[model samples]
Target chain A: MMGAPLLEVRNLESFYGPIMAIRGVSLSVEEGQIVTVLGANGAGKSTLLKTISGIMDPEKGSVSFDGAEIQGEEPHRIVSRGIVHVPEGREVFPLLSVDENLSLGAYTRKDRSAIERDREMVFEYFPILAERRHQEAGTLSGGQQQMLAIGRGLMLRPRIMLLDEPSLGLSPLLVQEIFAILGRLNREEGVTMMLVEQNARIALELAHVGYVMEIGRIVMNGDADRLMQSEDIKAFYLGQQEAGQRSEKRWKRKKTWR
Target chain B: MDGVQLLVSGLANGCVYGLIALGFVLIYKATEAVNFAQGDFMMLGAFVTLGLTNAEYLHLPFWIAAPLAILIMAFFGYLLDLLILRHLFGQSQTAVVILTIALGFVIRFVAGVIWGHEPQTLESPLAFGDVSLGGVVLGMADVAVIVVTVLLTWSLYQFFQRTKLGLAMQAASQNQMAAYFMGIPVKRVQGLIWGLSGATAAVAGILFASKGAIDPNAGLLGIKAFAAAVIGGFGSLPGALAGGLIVGVIEPFAARYLAAGYSQIAPYALLLAVLVFRPHGLFSQVRTKKV
Candidate 1:
């Protein structure tokens, strides 16, 4: 949509021990856009984010953030380059208080005044965290932990945030509220995001562009609204197709996409 | 001896064990590796100071030689991590523990080659005869030992609580991967913790050497310190001091109250009892990692 995408990937491959986890995967996120990768379990969505964030190395391919190649840099180096990854499990330090966890999020920054302002802004988004500022992170409820995770990521003032499964294990009401906040952040703060999720309906609703991943490769990509309307997606992912409503004898499944 | 005299002596010895156990906890906290070589590190520090202060050698005064020895040990700790422990990262925890045991042997052998096999006394300026308080008598060396232990422990507590670098070290020790994600230099922090542990071990060695005779086997005392760490809840500093006091007091009282031979096993018996009641140690809480 612009001169260049804010984040770009090409032919990425990664492995876990002896198993091939991600094979020749590629995707991109343009500035100010919310892109979502939707897939079932074992589809390598987390692997893709981990590779881009430099938590794991790719056997082949390049990852360029903004304009620089950062395929094999250390995770800390990647964060300083303005790409923050909120990992799948909401890994806030269990023993550390909420305040200390947020302070640690700004570990890489030297702009003290801006860090303070950002902390205030994070508290604005998650008022519960502010109320429990001195409480240990482990004691917070699941929804609160997810909020703390995002708030910690925000402390970095990242240009692009890679959030993995923000809606996982959350109640529908909580999921709706979290996605609404994410949408507001994108529209108001201009923060680009690449979200990975298995909850297809909510993910598609929040994303501008959606990619369907099966196994380790992208099988489908299009506007999120169009993908949501696709018959195959409606049948398989959205659970909208009932047995009597289908005209065909059996639904066809695509194996590959070019 | 009166009960008061026995208590003071027990506490003085406990302070020495506490100092050594603190070293064990420091290295273990940062790397999650139980360093069997910690006692050897203390022995090396004592040997270095002895070599420097010996009348035949440099003959440096205790004040100068002790600090110099600690500084060198600190450097040695950094190199030990850089040259050996750094490469062991991501390796099996059991393998690293065995390697540390090997490292202990290497240090002991090296010290034997350099300083001979005989035991010798370390001279201290404060070793002036015993000071008697009413009916109880206390050695000036014992008083010196207690004072140094309290001061060192307080300073280390302040360092961890007040400084950014120290907080980073604590954060790294708690969750290394999360700390790295937060942009902390985890590897460098591990190296610094090892250096700090080495410096603390050196202080323990100097204090032990000043109290009595020390030989190459002085490092064997590290095993007892390891027990102290476990009894105190391995990661907690104040627990280490408490564990040491418990162990130190138990041993001497065992000899006086129980059979003369019971003293040697008294500390271990207490360790076993604590383990039976609180397997995580007296001070540690059960931490369950989120899935």
Candidate 2:
């Protein structure tokens, strides 16, 4: 359902030492769509995000974004090329002030006026950041840091944003708010997203396309709605399909091991 | 000499200590590791000055030789960062200390081998005469030391606060990974910091050597610089200066007012007191770990 792929990974294999984290996995995201990678613990979701963003090199295949090869570029170079990655566990620089953290996101950009405009856009998306601009980031709560991380990523104004575990350690309310924000960014800003989440149900719900990665391999893939309704997805994650239920038993199962 | 005269001398010495302390802090902030080689870097600056000012090589005017020496030291600073310091990165802090300790021995041996172990002094514009105010004579070198240290520190403070590169350095010091993500050449900024530290150490070395005969073994003062850093708060530039001044002011006063043996213990006592009370340092932000 597309005009060639906006981002494509064909026969990609990423490794960590001798242990293979992503084995011959291929996926694609179109120009303006949300694609979520849903999986359980020990899955290759984080590696997939990192490898695409050029933080970790894939041992065996190509990562082509917008039909351009970006397999061997450095992470900063990848970011400068407009592929921003918000790493796992919200790796916001804790010692820096909120404003410093935001300013650093536009580190590679030299257009002062445009950078200032983007800064305002990010502040609008997360007003708490403006209020706590001078405050050191480490002191903020988990939810606020997650918001800051996203805000920092938004500072790049990237066409395709790769977010890794944006909801980890967040409260239920905060998680919902985060998902809502992601949905809005996709719908309103037309920013394509590659979201990796352990929360399989919500990830699939917000996504147009979903892939299930199990033990370093792409085990299942299809339309998000269909995957959400699949027996295997329900069996492992949803437990029982309640039409209005978002708080499923699978979260309790994932929390212990995540 | 009266109390005021003794106080003036102590203040000058304190300023030297503070400058060296700043050098220590500069390297530590960039690397998050101690460079025991810092004192040797300072000694090398003085030796370079001697070479330039010697009636042989660049035997140019004082104005030219002093700056040429500092620049040469800065170049070597960059070289050292490229060759030695860069290789030790990502290693444990303890390993960094050991590496630099080894570097210090090499620097001292090489400097002694190449330049000889003879004690020397760089030429100075100031004479032995002192400025007498209300019958207390303050040596010209003492006044020069204090005035120069204050002016240099103030200018450096302005530079760090105003310049974009300086801001980048501060960002890298706080969190290198975040800075790299921002498109900053974090490693290059680190090399620049090391170069700046080398330049600062040269200034401190030149000023300190003015008060005495310079020898290659003089780098042993790095221990004192380390104490100053610990006392001031490891990463705080202001703290390094204040710590240096505290140590400088303590030594002579203790020798004169208290027991001479107690002078050696004074700075350590202050450092211990500060460590036990505010470990993050007087000016440093308390780092919070995610764990």
Candidate 3:
């Protein structure tokens, strides 16, 4: 919260054809903080990210970043301005090699030496991508492709990273490891991030601030640890499963494969 | 003139089809929509060259004049992308396909109004003398057709692989939305791909005109280029050239043995046969979309 908030969404509303996905939504991200938007399926989390990134346009509200208004800017222009979105479903170019995918992420940059340096940093984060740099991404396992997807997003050296359900298809072990990396990246580099995820427990544990959405509106917002203690959250989200028992259920899910 | 002489000429004609087909392959790889007006692109190129040569405004040789006309053709391609084709982005496959078809008709009609339907001969670098190789005769013009095509294809290959812009084009063609997220100028990439396709078409037109017949509806033979694309797999560049060669080489043999009837359908027949077995194409990446 030093200079200014990194991103601010004020009264944002977006539509899909005739259906209103979100109505009168507002949020804010501090310059160097991890903000998590937690909600169940169809709660408009992905739509919010898409609208801010310019993949979709909102009929109302404003998306301002670092004091510059960027509501209607094209997605390509938005990326060059350093807001990188790692979309859901790991849409890596299936025919391209891992190295090529990473290089393409830096398409608008002119500093060749820095791009090379960043490439090494990305490989350090995801060693599997480095190991399979020459292999086509489509051939990689789902978890590996997900890593590559994140790695591709990192190539732009983005100031604010928007991730949608990063742990969706990952194993429990991998999920824990990925969240740890997100936490470390935020702490060490101060790269602001917005994570929209279904894993409420982990999202709440890692995020400094949390916002809960139901039926396309923020029903609750507070400190992550404090939100976890809210009776409504505990009753609606945590009531379905015991708190510590998620680990056991996750184990059972993993054991089926084993 | 003997059987060998006829074969050489036939192969040379086949090279022309391959050249135009490369344009088809180029645009298709970057945008899955077929520019039905592709043959028209070639026709436009040749027509431009003809107009330039007729005007003698630059007072340059064919070498200089040919490249200049191609540059103009590239501009037309860019304009086409900006004006009509760009709107088709992210649209349904069938809608884009039909849009291109309509655009092709517009280009054809414009060319007919400008350049009348009389055939004219271009200045051939080849002298009238023909060399007989083992009883096979090849005029220098015929050799020029094959040589020009090979050289053009080699240059295009280098353009696609070694250059940064070319690699970006490849990435954009594969998944444009992801490309946009990757910081690529997706709109510029689309415009440039159309420019490349137009330039390639122009070169093919000039080479064919050098051999014989420069007319307005000269785009008629552009149908063969479509066959080349289909035979080669619409998405594969090398496959298109190979498909062009296959169609080119087969027709003469078809004419010689199959009573001249099957010769015309050689490329289309080859396309149908390939589609029946390898629907993705001979060299295209095979993929399955989730239902």
Best by DockQ: 1
> How does model 2 fare in lDDT?
0.83
Query: lDDT per prediction?
Result: 0.87, 0.83, 0.82
Interface RMSD of each: 1.5, 2.2, 2.3
Candidate number with the higher DockQ (1 or 2): 1
Write the residue-wise lDDT of candidate 1 on B53-95 in tens digits. Answer: 9786789998899999999998899989999889987899998
User: What are the models' TM-scores?
Assistant: 0.95, 0.90, 0.91
- Best-matching candidate per lDDT: 1
- What TM-score should be assigned to candidate 1? 0.95
lDDT of 2 by residue, B60-119 (tens): 777787788888888888888988778877778998889889988998999898778988
iRMSD (Å) of candidate 1?
1.5
Predicted candidate 1 versus true structure: per-residue lDDT over A1-258, tens digit per residue: 768899999999988678778888888899999999999999999989988988889999899988999999988899999888887877787777898888888888989899999999988888999999999888888888899889898999998999999998888999999999999889988889999999999999999999998888888999999999886677667877545554544346443353
| lDDT score of residue A197 within candidate 3 | 87
Q: Please write out the lDDT profile of model 2 over residues A148-236, one tens digit for every residue.
A: 88988888888788988888888888899989988988888888999998888788889999998888878788999998887667767
Candidate 3, position B168, lDDT: 92
**Model 2 root-mean-square deviation:** 3.8
| Pairs in clash, predicted candidate 3 | none
Worst 10 residues of 1 chain A by lDDT: A249-258
